[model samples]
Target: MTFAISKTASQIAPFRVMKILAQAKALQAQGRDIIHMEIGEPDFASPSCVHQAAQNAAEQGLTHYTATLGLPALREKLAQFYDGFYHAKVNAEQLVITPGSSSALQLVLTAILNPGEQVLMADPTYPCNRQFVHLLHGEVYSVPVTADSQYQLTLDHLKQHWNPQIKAVMVASPANPTGTLIEQAELLKMAQFLAQRDTYFIVDEIYQGLVYERPAESILAHQNLPQNVVVINSFSKFFGMTGWRLGWCVVPEHLIDVLDRLGQNLYLSAPTLSQYGALAVLESDALTELEQRRQIFQQRRNRLYAAMQSAGFTLKTLPQGAFYLYWDVSEYTQDSERFCAALLQQTGVAITPGTDFGKEAGKSHVRLAYTNDRIEEAVQRIQGFVEQYR
Candidate 1:
């Protein structure tokens, strides 16, 4: 007998970058020299303080399952972090620790969305957001945002796309691929508008600490935030703790009990050792080191932006935050998927095709992460590839 897979499983698109990464790894196994710019993981290890804390936790046998909500101390530390960093008064009760921002997002959507409900977001987003919506049997309404609006959904855009079906509006600040941020005033206006309509507003602040030229602001910074407003953040990007897989979300007080119940069933709790380790991440010395690393990332962004332009790649927006450069490769190829695959095979440089984000405007684009130490080498390889292919 034959069995049928779930429709949701069928609708999920494969992460094309991972496929390129696999090929790159295969080439590397064959002794090929590959410069990776495809994946968005930071190359740095967790700070020494965090590593020490993890070691101590292990020695002390703090490996047992923490409370479903989280270790009380870690939750309190995160709550205080918001007050100190963003000037937002987030009580410990408002925070939920999840395995990662990915899982946090899933739990948030699961807690809020019913079947056939919809969430509106910009096209060419982080890719997983739409997939999570699909997994929950909800619809994703992707608004096509351009560089003019900094690839962000404006209040006017939200108004234009407003319908009873749109249950929530999700956006990433210093957004993935584009690395553009929504101004605080615009965010406030959106909050007010959504509040008036009783619609949910979810901001993905995964890259908050990675912003440049402007201070990182949290949606929680707004004292009058709508009851439905939620913020998701992770240690993966800024703290260089990707493998630790720990992240937290700030939810409305009313949904705390619901999420508590959901968290109980999720993974029991985020990794206990990681939580203990993350406690040291917010220390003054660790933050100073992290700030220095941020400067390095900013420099890499500058170097790549200039190099990509010199290589004849069209860049519409300069990245202000995060460590990604999204380029319009229309001059080279209309099919970004083919362009990426061929570039990897020929030059041994792996990059992400924009098609992985969305098919609309993403067809003529590619996203390169500046997370590697060999930015100059990657630049040279890309320039040579463009000279040959274009």
Candidate 2:
């Protein structure tokens, strides 16, 4: 007898990048040379300091459960991080550590949304966000964003799309796929508007430290942060700690207890060893090492950007942060998924189809991650593939 699947489980779309990655691995196992440009994980290992810290924790028998809200010292360090990095004043009391930014997002959405309440976010966003909302039986209202706005949501977009059903507005800086940022003035305007409507503003800052052109700032930089604002961040990206499965979120003071209780039940606590490692990375030496890696990523971005443009790919916006280039592949194929699969099979170059992100403009686009060190080789392969179509 077949078991029935829940609607949430059935309707949640698969993250297509992982599928492509699996296929890419299959080819690699068969001795095919694959140039990976699909996954967003940084190629670098976690800082030496973090490694040392984790070892120390393990040796000291610090593997026991931490407070559900996380180690007080780690939370306090993150608060100081905001002050030193963004000149933003954050209270340690407002922070909650979780297994990953994914968990942080889950807690925030669960705390604020009732079933059927809506979340407004840009289309072509990180694919999992809509799934997160769907998991809670909430609705996602996607606003189609384009290159004209640098693929970011503007205050005007929010004003036009606002509806009574929308309980929250979520956006990411150095956003996934596109690697673009929301303009600061526009972000501020949108935040104030949401505050007036008693709606929550959720900012995803997982890629905060990898910015290229400008210094990254937290929304808390505002002298008076709105009570409804929530900021989610992680050690996964810039800190090169993806495997550590650690992240944190800063919420309004009023929601601290709600998140603490929710975290206690849902996660019990983030990984204790990972928490200790995170503490080491927050120090000045580790930060300096991360900065050097940022420069390397910037260099990779520059090299790949020019090569892709030279290969006749249409890149509408130069990525400001993160390590992705969402380029239009419509000139070659209208079906990005098919294009990606064929490209992988034929050229052994793996990249993600835009369909993984959203419906609008997805078929015409593809996202290439520059996270791997083989970018130059990948572009050489991509150039040859494009030339065949041309």
- Number of the top lDDT candidate: 2
Model 1 CA RMSD to the hidden true structure, in angstroms: 1.3
Which 10 successive residues of model 2 have the least lDDT summed? 381-390
lDDT of 1 by residue, 1-390 (tens): 969898879988888888989999999999999998988988888898988998999999888999988889988999888988899899998899999899899999999898899999998899999999999999999999888898889999988998888888999998998898988888888877887877888989999989987777887888777787899999999888999999989999988898889989878889999998888887537988888989999989988888877766678999899898888888878899888888889889999999988778888899999988787788788788877654
Candidate 1's TM-score: 0.97
lDDT of 2 by residue, 256-307 (tens): 9999889999989999999999999997488888899999999999999988
TM-score of 2: 0.98
- The residue-level lDDT of candidate 2 at 316 comes to 92
Query: In model 2, what are the clashing residue pairs, if there are any?
Result: none
Quantify all predictions' global Cα lDDT against the true fold.
Answer: 0.88, 0.91
List the lowest-lDDT window of 10 residues for candidate 1: 381-390
Q: Which segments of candidate 1 are over 4 A away from where they belong?
A: none
